[model samples]
Target chain A: MTDGIPAAPGTDAWFHDGPDGFVLLAGRCTACGALSFPPRPIPGCPNPDCDGLEQHPHALSTTGSLWSYTDARYVPPPPYPRPPDTEFSPYALAAVELDAERMIVLGQVAPGVAVSELTVGMPMRLVPGVLVSSAGVEERVWNWRPGA
Target chain B: MSRPDSVAVLGVGMHPWGALGKSFVEYGLVAARAALADAGIGWRDVQLVVGGETIRNGYPGFVAGSALSQALGWQGAPVASCYAACATGAQALSTARAHILAGLADVVLVVGADTTPKGFFAPVGGDRPDDPDWLRFRLLGATNPAYFGLYARRRMAIRGTTEADFAAVKVKNARAGSLNPYARFRAEVDAETVLNSPMVSDPLRLLQICATSDGAAAVVLASEEYARRKQRDAVRIRAISAITPEYPRTVPDFPYLASDSAAISPPASRTFRESLAWSAYESCGLGPEDMDLAEVYDLTTAMELDWYEEIGLCAAGEAEKLLHDGATALGGRVPVNASGGLSSFGEAIPAQAIAQLCELTWQLRGDAGTRQVAGARAGVAVNQGLFGHGAAMVVAHA
Candidate 1:
């Protein structure tokens, strides 16, 4: 519980610091054993047939392989809190394959990692980072760093 | 698939795709009036009007159907507005068809127009945590081009597609665009120019991606019986399919942070884009080999290659080969984007899908002067919008 480190204000349900460190939160259906991320109150499973009404909170895998990657060279418009164009720098994004969940999750790559350093199938691990810092309050977010 | 009764496209009109500083209504009116005149029918003869809604304009754009009807001097026609991102025009056509088939109205006018804002299209205002569109921008700063870049990079890694293959798409489409007066970018581009352009996203240069433009398109559709009565030789719409991706969708589409986990249910046999084409083919009782021409959404040069496979024009991973063989050129077996595609026309959001059909209608009628495909009989238009909205239409000469 450090000042600069907290689950991104409203996204606490999606990511949290587990015993092993940052892990994605998910929901597992008790009836059909289906797993989904961004935990939701269950009365339904994404599966059409299974009448799975009950779901319990589950922690997702912390590491995954890079499925794909790209860099945002242009400044995204409003609501993104982008810095002025002159001070803007591109950041890399990675789509990681969470093998356990059998799904691909997207996130920004850890700061300072250029696009050239990344490759498909490269190992990546989830970690906490700052989305934005304002008025002494740091809005925490998740980043995928190159590692196991 | 059972054949639904076909609808006849009596007329097609468009306000040229460019950065025209005009309101959406003005554009819509121009296209609508031209379509009505082309059909040899008065505006008052139209019984129903369907409009593709634009997200840029606040209240007026939202109620586009009524707003456009009002601008055209409301004759008490029932109005409906639809929003489906870039597929908005196709959805509006679908709505008009539903009315025509249900015996609600015989003649319906469909219009779509947009005055796109400059720069990257951002999410609507506010910090509503529930909105995924806002979250992607706020959390990852992922612009639309970023998503396109990710897909492009994935295609290269998986299929070994080269940068030259992508530049070829621009060259071919731009050549066709030069012949199209409605297209914004009329000059043909070379591979060298595309390669030298500034990189908007990795593996994609400025020339490779479509720019946002202000444009409008309109089409007048009438029942088969009505067309016969009017003695109008019109392009017939055999089928229009608007299909969404099924559950356990493995591919991460735009505006979504994560794809549905395949841990529970397996992904569908066919990809989303493939399903869209299949639905159109099944409904029309026709396959890719039967099509004389096609108009596909080329938001990016790489995307056009992907569409070649999705629409069954070529086998999977063979899109680059199709391009290499000149199979997709104007004189090839099946010409694609004869209307210059989004690469030349850019994107007008709501108007894009309708503009695709306009190209098909003209091509099928042998009226596409300079860019005409020889003796074109059947044509298809395919487009996919954000949030799983996929659309395809089959048009044939009557």
Candidate 2:
């Protein structure tokens, strides 16, 4: 954290460094027992048949397995906040499957992990990281690191 | 069981695909005129017009039906506009078919045109956190190729597919594209060329990906009676299936941060793309074995392989084996992308699905000079778009 505040507000609600460890906020449906990440905005369960409007905030398991991975070799177009072209370096993205949630989540991998170093089915854990540094404040984002 | 009533495709036309410095309206007019002339029907004869919307053209793009009708000298024909991302053209054709089958129109003109911007397609301006497309680009810098790369890597891991298999797709499609006059990239490519190309995403080379291009495609469809009066033999549209994924979609799709969890229930046996093809097969009472040719959305060489399995041409994880056996190449069993595919045409967005239909029509009619699938009878065109849009059409000789 910079300036004693999270760079991207509201993002902290999704993931933060708790006293125990990293926890991901998710939504659990009371009626159908459905679970969703990033929480549904409508306050209702996605299940069409179940009219479960009462959604309770729940913490998701931080550990998962690498379902897939890729390396972005080219620079993407705008609105993607990044350093200048000269400072740019390719980064690897990973899709991790949380066994408890039975869902796959996508995130940037930790800085040092290269594409060659990673393999499918490798265990990974969620960790807080910086997406970009601007105005002397590091934009908080989540990353997947190899090992639980 | 008696087959459902069908609509006849009286004529089909297209504007060559490439980076042309022209407006979409200009290209649309040329394709519309050619289609009308080919059908031997005047513009005034068409009772309805359906146009595929283009995102690049501002507000007018939303009302593409009226814009194209105006460009063709409108005769007060009823107009409908549709947008389903890359599946726009198929939706437009479906709309025209509905009008004809319902007795609302005797003849319908279906058109789709687009002038794509250079570089990777970015989200429309403004920051709307609710917009998934914007979030994907802003948070992860995930371009379209990034998603393609992920799928390719997953296939490699799960199916033991090799990079050489991916490169082989490019070589095969490029060779077919060399015979297609309408294709932008007419030069044949080899495995060396694909391997030597710079990497845009891991496991995918630059030449293996499609580029953005400008193009237009149109078709004239008529009621069974009207078509019989004009020409006894015409290409008949047996079915056009535009389907969305079922709830709890397990597979990862574009513009999404995560896949829907399957905690409450097990994932479906069929994937989203497989279901799309199955819907068309059920609608037409035909299976993959009935197909003589196919034109699929090959946004990347790897994607083409995925389509081969999804379309039921082979079993899961056997697409590479099918390719190696020369079953998907021109003159092979169930030849695919005989029009050279997006690998050769690049992507013109709205125009692509209709362009696929144009190739199918030519092949069925024995009019495709050089790239003809000999003795072709029935063909299928399959495509998927962002935000859960999937479309497929089955066509055969009347």
Among these predicted structures, which one has the highest DockQ?
Answer: 1
TM-score of the second chain for every model? 0.98, 0.98
Per-residue lDDT tens digits for candidate 1, residues A73-117, read 887786776433336668899999999888888999988999999
Q: Write the per-residue lDDT of candidate 2 for residues A1-148, one digit (tens) a residue.
A: 2334463533546665666876777788988888776677667887766798987778888999999988888778867776544467788999899998899988889898889988999999998777663233457778898997
Each model's lDDT comes to 0.87, 0.87
Model 1 stretches with alpha carbons more than 4 Å out: A1-4, A41-43, A83-86, A133-136, B1-4
Segments of candidate 2 deviating more than 4 angstroms: A1-12, A84-86, A133-137, B1-3
Tens digit of per-residue lDDT, candidate 2, span B55-173: 98887788888889999886999999999999999999999999989989989999999888988999988866667788788777888898888899999999999889999999999
Q: List the residue pairs that clash in candidate 2.
A: none
Error of 2 at B96 (Å): 1.3
Where's the lowest-lDDT run of ten residues in candidate 1 chain A?
Answer: A129-138
Candidate 1, residue B14: lDDT? 94
